[model samples]
Target: MIGRDAELAFLRRVAAEARAGRGGAAVVRREAGIGKSALLEQTARDASGMRVLRVTGLEAEAELPFAALHLLLRPARHLVDGLPWAQQAALRVAFGQGRDEAEDRFLVGLALLTLLSDLAEERPLLCLIDDAQWLDRASAEALGFAARRLGADRIAMILAARDGGNGAEPHLHGVPEVRLAGLARPDCEGLLATVAADLAPEARDRVIEEAEGNPLALIEFAGMLTPKQRAGHLVPLPLHPPQLPVVSRVERSLRDAIRLLPERTQRLLLIAAAEGTGNLDLVLRAAKESGAGLPDLEPAERGHMLRVADGRLRFRHPLVKTAAYREAPLVQRVAVHQAVARALDAEEDADRRAWHLSAAAVGPDEHTGDALAAAGDRARQRGSHASSATAYERAAQLTVSPHRRAARLAAAAEAALGAGQLRRARTAAHRGQRLTDDPPVLARLATVAAMADSELGRAAPAAHTLIDAATGVTASAPGDAAAMLATAADDAWFAGDAWFAGDHAALRRAANLLESLTPRADASLAPVIGTVRLVDGEPAVGLALMRAAVPADDRGAGTIVGTYAVFSALMTGDDDAACALAAARVDRCRERGLIGELPHALQLLTQALGCCSHAERAGSVGIPAHCGPAGRWAMTGVSVGVVRRSTRR
Candidate 1:
């Protein structure tokens, strides 16, 4: 608060606007100990007459899907029943309270927005998220989704995250940001004076310089000084090696403080750090198993290192928890993880228990691997694709059989692709391919890798990979081979479009490949085949096929087939058909809350409108503001630009 007046003022304005039903959000980003958390705390205190919800991300739970979001919304669980049934079911699945079934990730996010808006009906709500960089990918995405769509609602979200390190969070990229910098000279000197007023002039100046405007460092360095050092009778050693980063120096200081604590107190802190959820009962059970008890936590409390409140234990700073876990010996860390795993309720906390067991394993353990694989299945059921990828990756690492490992890696790659982690999907797929020679598994891996590559703009290579994969499986799994060929056609189209505006070489090659396969009576493949034919100079036949594939109902219009049909119509200059199909797709997306598909649908519709010469209608298209960066890009990018160009032509 000392040097953060301007930042605080901005947050105040956000809060004021939200209170007046013009909601907004801001992400506070900075290096460790730059007062991001403190700023949020100060803002919470200043927001009088508002309901406040706070959730801090824990490193130990970073791979657990929706963990932070579950914690943040625990107080509002009663409001879930008020949401639409689809939204209710999505929330229930995400929070692990309902039958295991896949739910759209964006639907879960919309459910969160609705629940929070309901809560804010009584009073303005301030949601503070600290250490957001450590939030699980699913939780971060869900939170970002809700934050971007709080329009006309009495809610203000402020997320604080560490930047410029391995912990950087890219999920919150599009939110308004307030970056904190090192304090100015006068502010640094003032802060140092408050913590080390009696220090000798030279030592005080040295402390200020060494602290480098970090408030935590200023207070901690001063606290570490001896009487002699303070009085100038003896020089204090440098706070840390000059080469160490500021965060490392602070963590080292915190570790030293932990070492000075009683052995039992250190063990208690370790248990708390390992548990991560701060569930005091779970911590106590784990501590009891580890030869520590509730009494041992008193020392840490008195030292202002952590606090126990409302049956939960919380560290004073995220770095304290990090230091407690990292400074411990590997054996001790493993033992704590095992103890925590044992303390978990076998039926209720199986996912967390499986993760802890995996963490505790020192070598290949098939049982642990199986447990993690099951955890991955549960994550996938909840549509937490990033968490599913992490669980499967860990499972693959612990499995002894190469085939099983390959299968797990394949699953990981698939989940990563669903999570939009293109590079991770490609890497996992490549690893899976290297492990297995089975044609089916190889084909699966190749398909995933090619899809990832196509999205990453390697369309030509992607098409080639898909073609080879389809050929390898053509005899045994004709259905899968045909599906791969269909995808290959799409990629080939992209390749041709990207390289030469009107070139048909890639499309011709793909068309020939598809024609060689025995065609099945699958309606889904019609548009894909039609697209190939259109680019292969058979416009009349292509347009007829594409027109036949167009859905007669709105429900089917929100599908991949519908997307391709729209594209084909556009290509063949059937403006009326293209606009109608595209409009239906957008309408279905909005009605069903299919936020993930809305951006693409909007883009296609905008292009269709342009082709139909409805420039005014295209300009006035109702693109959702909550559709994140993708929707914004669709509105401003080539989707709209190409439409304008076509109209001009």
Candidate 2:
């Protein structure tokens, strides 16, 4: 709280921006015990009246994917019911509350953003995180992902992390950090004097020297001294005593303070620490089982180590929990985890139970892995792709069989891709590929890689990926290979990437591959055949075949076939047909909630509309021999092909 005026001011600015609907986030970085948490708490106070949500990371649960985030968002669970079904399912899957299914992880982030935006419509929202260094990978990525997209939402986030610590994950790189340094000399001296007013001059000087500028260290060290020591009864401090980090010394002081409390009281505090989140009933039950009663918690509550508020036991600072658990014996810590897991033993809460058991497991266990996999499956079915990926990844790690592990890893990779986690998808894919060379597994990896490449606008690589995959699978899965070739041909022709756009060899390869496949009576076939014919000097024949492919009614053709029809019409110089097809595709995309696909449909519609307008403008003079870009490209290409064939004859 002392010497943090500038930091507080920055937080206030963030809060003000969020309140005014221009959301922002600030990452407060400093070493442990440097008052980062204190500044965050002050920011929460400064932003009074806003809906505040607090989540603190615990080292114990840092490996549990989404643990910190689940705590951060649990209060907003009611908002899930109002999200789109996919998003709703995604959130549930992430939280382990629904059936597991592959879900777009961004969908969950979008859902959380939308939920907060919806809540902020009534009042601003403030989110505070302490010890962000220990936040799980998935939660950290998701939060950073969501934080970057909060421009128009009424949300402010303040994250506190130890600078240069193990928690400094790359996801935190872009977020602005407010590096907190030691308090000023005056502020440090003033705080010490205020807390230990009766201290003699020499003892005060000694405390200040050892305490340096760390506010927590100064206060905790001040409280550690006896009246006699404060009165200069202790020996004068050496000029250069063995130095320890202020945060470490502060933790040692906390450990000494914990030793002064009664055994049962200390045990109660340890139980609270092990549980992490202060679900009052669960903690109370765990304490009771540990032979402690409500009376035992009274001392810690009175001493300000914790407080009971609104059915939750809130820690004064997250460090208190860390210290409490850290000071406990290794066996004692294990016992407490088991006790907490036992207390949370509800069949309906299998995912959480599995997690607790996973934590308590001394070593890898296949049964536990099976439980997690089952939980993941449940989550996936509910459309929680993020959670499903996490569970599957962990399950794969725990599996004993090489083949099963590889298969699970592949599933995790696919789910990560579905969640739009490209880096994670690539990692999982590479790991799976390292384990096996099964055709199906390779196909899945290739599909995910190709999709990621296409989404990232690397059209050439994506087109090659599809073609190579098709070639690899041709003998074993001819139908699938044909489908892949069809996609490759489309990309090679119109993706607009230099690698594919002018790669005549790739186009010919795609066309030849499609030609070799046993043709099926599928709607997509017309576009494939027409595309081949158009580029093969049979423009009229290609246009006729494309026209025949169009369904009798808009309802029958569907968007995919309809979209191809629009392009074919434009190529054949039928402006009216192109306009009608493009308009219908746009309408269908909108009706189906295919928002991501709507832009493409709109782009085609715009081209079609422009062509129609130009055709009308030329009506009085008769349609121009050359019309739009597509028309010109088609006419020129076909004419050149015709001339070449005639010269050969």
Candidate 3:
């Protein structure tokens, strides 16, 4: 509020643009206590006259599917009846009101999109979600899906989260993001003066230096001192100054402030933190069981720890709720989790109940582990891979059997990979590797490692992983082994790694492995065979095989064979077909959100466009002539000499 004029102006303009029928989306991320909530509040104010909807994520409700979306759209529920019957039914199924036997997640996302578009038809819609990191996976993905597809719907979305917060949505990665930083020194000093006008020069210098220009730390530390201490008239106590970063100082302030409240009032805050949804009924139920009542909430209200609005309670800041839960005793935390778990109906909110049961567990419990695994399964079915990874990882921790724990950990790795969390996938894969050496387990781990490495641009390691996997499983799983070999050959050839293509040894090895597979009819085997044969000097046979492997319908298959097929077309002097294929591949990759495949598609499209002299359209793939794919792929003997531009960044 003090020094955010620039940010406020930008957000106001975005809102104005949305009101004028231009859809927009922005993600604001920063460290905790850096005033993300304050920025969000100002966004709501700037969106005046617009139909502003709000949803705040809660750590306790982080596992509840569609919980955040339901909260955000509850006020606009009447509009759902006007949507197409299919969309309305999809929403009902998503919210557990209808049959969920074969529910499609994309349909749920489409339903929410239509519902928002309908609302926008009446009035511009401004959706502000604070603490997006804690949004349930289904809700985060659905909201992100809608945000991406809005064209001219007069809708704007603003999301705020701490950097790397749990349950973060990847779909928002491409959205315009602003990282809020600490205030500058001059601005910090000016703000500090507003809160501590009587501070002496020496004391003020010490406080500012310790705060490191963090606005929240400056304000909290200034308030904790008396006027006399501020003016250097009284000696300060020997308490330690807050450590670096704004979040720690805020946490200390919140914890210290809560200690001033009565025992029952503090307990009430804890219960609310535990439930997270701000559902008054659920909180009251939990509070009653904990021997507290409605009167207990008054003290918190007076203390400004919470506010009641439309029969729900909201914490003053996102930090207060976090601090309350974090600072509670272990036994008390477990008891509250158990109480909330007991309150949620297992049939309706099984995922939440499972998560709460896991939270309440003090040690290994197979039943809780099984419940968590089931929750992970449900999350997977809903396309919430990241959430499924978390649930599976937790389930692994709770399982007593070594093999089952290893299997769960491996599953977590696979889910994390599917969610595009490469670091987590690597960690989970490594842990699983240490726990088991079974060939099948090793093969799965190797495949995960190879795919992650390939996405990260470490082609050699990826090829090595593929080769190892192929070697380990060739005897028992011939089809998988052949596929892995083909993948390795393509990666090596495209990456132009010296070991694979400098002398063609790697490609030969991969080809040899494929040949040993008894010449099966698997479509995947074609690209590698063709590429290896072509590179090794059998051009006619290679072109024939590659052409046959190219999928007629899937323009953006982005597979190893697909890349070679495009190259084959270009080599045959079919520049027009090649460009069209490349463009289609790019479009398909974007449509499916295949981020890992996008780079390849873009590179291929750039080459094709350059060869066709479509210079004006080169910007579409975000590449210049100097860095076209032709030169980049030339190291492996697949050069397009027609486009003789340097492929440099």
Q: For this target, which candidate reaches the highest TM-score against the unseen true structure?
A: 1
TM-score against truth, every candidate: 0.87, 0.73, 0.73
| Higher-ranked by lDDT: 1 or 2 | 1
lDDT of 1 by residue, 1-649 (tens): 6888899999999999999999989999988889998999999999998999999887778878888899999889889887766677778888788895754667787778888988999789999999898888888988887787776799999999888532227668789999988888789878877777898877777777777888887887777887888876566554788588777988998999999999999998988898888899999998886578989999999988999999989898888899999989999999999999999976978988998998899999999999999999989988899999999999999999999899999999999998888999999999999899889889989999999999998888888898888778877887787677767766776675544443366566655666666465245567777887876779888878777765543353325456677777777677777877777776565555556776687777766776665444444455443444444445643332232122222
Q: What's model 2's lDDT at 478?
A: 74
Q: Which has the higher lDDT value, candidate number 1 or candidate number 3?
A: 1
After superposing candidate 2, which stretches have Cα over 4 Å from the reference? 13-31, 44-177, 199-212, 225-249, 252-271, 284-305, 308-311, 326-338, 378-386, 452-522, 525-570, 573-649
The per-candidate count of clashes, in order, stands at: 0, 12, 2
CA lDDT scores, all candidates in order: 0.81, 0.71, 0.75
Model 2 worst lDDT run, 10 consecutive residues: 639-648
lDDT of 3 at 279: 83
Candidate 1: where is the Cα deviation over 4 Å?
165-168, 184-203, 497-521, 537-560, 566-581, 606-649
* Clashes by residue pair, model 3: 626-647, 626-648
Model 2, residue 102: distance off in Å is 7.8
